[model samples]
Target: MLNERISAAKQIASELHAAQEAIDEVMIRIARLAGTLPAARRDTNMSAIVGQDAMAKVAQALAASGDVRQLLTDAHLALTATQKQVGLGTRMFGAGVKPPSAMFADEGSNDRGVVTALAQAS
Candidate 1:
């Protein structure tokens, strides 16, 4: 049962990551479309003026995508915390984390990786 639950958690995490990536890709595509559209430098006609104003909608879409990004990030963070609570430790899934070579690492290894590696070694 425990093994099944862990497996399920792993699958959920994977799916969550995939969903986040898909949303990001969509935002990128929209942004590229926005760039591809010809700029309306002069509002000489209704079409040009509308084109200029349409960018506001594009900007709103980008802003909405940003909100979605935050939601995905929050979900990821919550899953990480859940992993820690379930005795999964601080190791990143499918990634190796090593402590800094420095004797003391508060300042040295903040970027090195998770400190759990050091704790487990000693």
Candidate 2:
């Protein structure tokens, strides 16, 4: 029973990891599509304006990237920790082990990959 629960937890973690990886890949693809700004002009004043605008765009992109990065990091941490907790819970529950609860907290949260993965894992 313990082994089964641990297996289940690890399975869920793997699925979540995969889903996050897919999302990250998509974000990267989109960012690449957006592309970087062209080089600034040689004129100091004109270059300054261009540079400022470019910096603004870069800052916006960085902000967006930071949010996505945070989400991805959170997903990774949640997956690893949840897997460990589920494994521990399995041992604690012993003969009639119960599955981890938090795993279902984000159920139907518009993440098809996640939902599918959870279904497959469970």
Give the winner by TM-score: 1
Cα lDDT for residue 17, candidate 2: 61
What TM-score would each prediction reach against the true structure? 0.65, 0.41
Backbone clash pairs in model 2 (N, Cα, C under 3 Å; residues 3+ apart or in different chains), count = 0
Cα lDDT of model 2 by residue, 41-75, tens digit = 44233554666666676667666876877887677
Q: Give the range where candidate 1 is weakest over 10 consecutive residues by summed lDDT.
A: 96-105
Candidate 1 lDDT (Cα, whole model)? 0.65
What do the candidate models score in CA lDDT, each in turn?
Answer: 0.65, 0.55
Question: Residue 68 of model 2: what lDDT?
Answer: 76
Q: Measured by C-alpha RMSD in angstroms, how accurate is candidate 2?
A: 12.9
lDDT (C-alpha) at residue 3 in model 1: 81
Model 1, 68-102: lDDT tens digits are 99998777777766766776544444323323442
Per-residue error for 121 in candidate 1, Å, reads 21
